[model samples]
Target: MVQPAPYLLGRFLDPIFAIGVGTLSYIQYERNTHREPGHTLYDLLQKKFFATKEQTQEKK
Candidate 1:
């Protein structure tokens, strides 16, 4: 079945909005936390996806 244009647009935009907000939130969180100096956004995201709990806590 063919979906309506608005519904298709909404489906496309939902993830974009969520990712944009989530990225901003993560940047804010990294600023508030004890992350290493001079870390880039990529670094922060990488740590977020890859670092373990103990590793993150160790920075505190």
Candidate 2:
């Protein structure tokens, strides 16, 4: 038998939305980290997102 409970449907979908958003943000962070030309992970992910994001960063 089928039920017509809209509230129950929404409650189940809420966690799915949150998980999807979190996964997307995490993937973006990983991409930015790997594509960055910095020598170390620390330097690449910490800097501003400028045009030189793909260019080599000089040592400070």
Clashes in predicted model 1? 0
lDDT of 2 by residue, 1-60 (tens): 999656633887878978888878876786777755565444546665443635544633
In lDDT terms, which candidate is top? 1
Please, what are the lDDT tens digits per residue for candidate 1 over residues 1-60?
998556534877978988999999988898888678758687767798989999989999
Candidate 2 is scored at a TM of: 0.40
TM-score for candidate 1: 0.48
Please list the residue runs of candidate 2 whose C-alpha ends up more than 4 Å from where it truly belongs after superposition: 1-9, 35-60
Candidate-wise lDDT, in order: 0.81, 0.64
Angstrom error of the Cα, residue 3, model 1: value is 13
